[model samples]
Target: MRGPEARPRFGLSLRLLALTLVFVLLAEALVFLPAIGRARVVYLEQRLAEAHLALLALEATEDGMVDGDLQRRLLGHAGAVAMTAYQSGFFRLRLGPDMPPRVDAAYDLREVGLWPPVGDALMVLTRSQPRLIRVAGISPKDPRVAVEVTLPEAPLRRDLMRFARRLLGLSLIVSLIAGAVVYFSLARLLLKPLSRLVAAMRRFEAAPEDPGRLHTPSTARHEVGEAERTLARMQARVREGLIEHARLAGVGAAVARINHDLKGILTTARLESDRLEAQTRDRDPDLARTTEGIAQALDRAVALCAATLSYAGSELPSARPRRLAAHHELTLAAQRLHQAHPEIAVNLDCAVDTTLSADPDLLARSLDNLTHNAAQAGARHLTLAAHTSNHQTTLTIADDGPGLPQRARDNLFQPFAGSARNGGTGLGLPIARELTQAMNGHLNLHQTTPSGTTFHLTLPT
Candidate 1:
């Protein structure tokens, strides 16, 4: 249920500890069970061997077969301290009042071989008698006769049960201690890095720009180091972007102040041109031509000033779709170009019925910047053309001038970069590109050939 950022949320180290503990406990159980059984067997075999040797000694008496007197003497002595001496089963001697009482219910003895010399060749199980180990050997002088001993199993069973409980207790204590030590060691060595990473993230959220906070120190030389470096880089890039946005806001404010006064001057120029056109009409043809040219120049100046002001504005209005004549935007671009370079002649080439959905004012500004750039490259003739392709409309402005310089090509449409010509404010291409994109359109440099340069403006149908 927790997200990735949540701390100590069943991480890699804890999972590894859990898996390792299961295996360790299983292995201990395997060894502990078998080891307790083996210890009980070894002790039982030593006691049985000792009891059988005493019976053999008793057979050495003058009565060569079974010795009742020797048996009674041995039983009285050995049974007194059987449990303490063997730490296993009891010792018993037959043929005495103290010998195991005969039971009406008795079962035949079955020989169950304990591995190697550890236990007797046969043992007895009976409902009315105690469980037993049967030990027997031949008389030293008479091959026909045999000596025998019976050891009760109660003491051995009790001792083995006690030893098993102790062994299990020790194993439990040891495993718990080992698990705790391993857990602490892993928390320090492995989980420590993750803890530092969490603390660093907290600091980053609290006061990201504060240089007073120390960053997480990376000790690992593997992918952890790479992660630390990557986080630092991302923080740096974010900081730089914030600074750039602030700078752009300031620039916008300053341009807005300058545009107010420039608009007033443009208004005065338009009024003067209107008066000149009224006087030169019909009476002097040559003078009227010159007056019209002055009016066109003034109009271009006003439009150029407006475009610069629009660039300084925070946002421009959306394009209003209307019936746009083919030559309207081109005429505006040519008039604006004449204000800066009157010698250049701009020609419009089309089938004359082309139309596009766009804001004429914004499109003219875009084309004016392009034509002015071409003129500055020593272009003597400029061409503006309109065409349609695959449900889209395109406007192209080209010139027979030098191509764009190599240095500015990469960032030609980015802000503050494409100012290779004199009297060029670098924002022109960038603003043009921005406005074009806002209209759901695109502006691209179609070519930079030796004979001329071309720019393409494409708008969706």
Candidate 2:
């Protein structure tokens, strides 16, 4: 047995066909009702006209009468068993035998309403046995006089049934032709394009990384066409993202290998720097200072290598939470910032002596990244301020820099794409944010304008 998706069933074509057929039949039925009624009326009127003409012939005779044989012939020609003519409020002529046993129904041809003829016609059609009906109308030749006739309902019913059958057959033919035309037209215009889109989506889903599997959208300027265009654009973006991910994966592998070898080299250089420092401490102070600078640079290099390795391995260094005085951490970061960029002025203002619960090293590293970024942006004056509010310690770092560019601000904190300065890897801010988050702290760029830029760092106190 086939599943629901695999089962074959009626589609839009069949549905449209059935709908068209039903609508056409309904329309024909509406026309048939009034048409049958009108047919019955016309039949009675024709019989009355024949009877009137026969009466005229009888009146033309000298005695205003006809032989029995001639009378029978006239009534047979009019298709009525009996007929009477009245002129000037007097009976002028009478034909055929006496009145029938009973009249099943009576109709006034001069009746004004729409439903009377229809009702009479329905009575005729529904009668179980042949009926004798009486029809009265003004004579066509003489408007002042009236003619009456009695006719069997069987003939009229037969004619109406024949007409109905022909109409039904014609309606079926027209519906079939119309449904075919509509089905093919819509199938080509709508269903075919939709089917193509579905097939394309399935193929793309099966192999999303394959750029060639993406759909080529239709150029039609319709709603369906717009959907196709949107899907195409989305598929393009997805493909680009996949390609970028693959490239990043490769770069990560290369960085991991470099970090492994470079760590050993930095360790050796650190040992040599320490040995040189010990030897020169008793001799030249300038040489000792230079060795100390070399040792500091080596330490920074090793830290950066470790950070890169950690990021590449998708493992952020876990934070060891501790309580530390906010003022002390701020002063230390400020002193380091000044040492790194001595030409830049530093101002530290701590109005709150708050102890913050966070990883001290991680907090200091985030502050260092923010200050170093400010210095690199040609900032001349850097201000570090701290305050405690609602059991939270907020640190504000403002700088008199040219401010970040719009592109950098948009992609800020996104690794490899957010670098503001040339020849700089865009990893600093993202790593800072990662470290801040691990310490349960928040870091954000508060504002950036032509005059300056500011950063906000918040930690629990």
Weakest 10 consecutive residues, lDDT, candidate 2?
A: 1-10
The runs of at least 3 residues in candidate 1 whose Cα sits more than 4 Å from the true structure, single-residue gaps closed, are: 1-182, 214-237, 260-408, 419-461
Best by lDDT: 2
RMSD of each: 15.1, 12.1
User: By TM-score, who's the top model here?
Assistant: 2
Which digits, one per residue and each the tens of the lDDT, describe model 1 over residues 1-461? 23345555787777868966776678778767566646655554455445445545544656533556665565554431221112123333323344444332221122323342223211211123446544444323333434343455555566666776787788888777777787778687666666666667677666656554436456568665666766666666665676677797888778767776777887797788778778878788788788788777767666656766766665754676555766666777788888889999888886666777777777776777777777777899999888988867898888898778775677798655676664455677787777787777899998887787788988764
lDDT (Cα, 0-100) at 94 in candidate 1? 29
What TM-score goes with each of the models? 0.40, 0.53
Count of steric clashes across candidates, in order: 1, 0
Instruction: Give me the runs in candidate 2 sitting further than 4 Å from their true place.
Output: 1-8, 87-90, 99-101, 112-123, 140-144, 221-227, 241-461
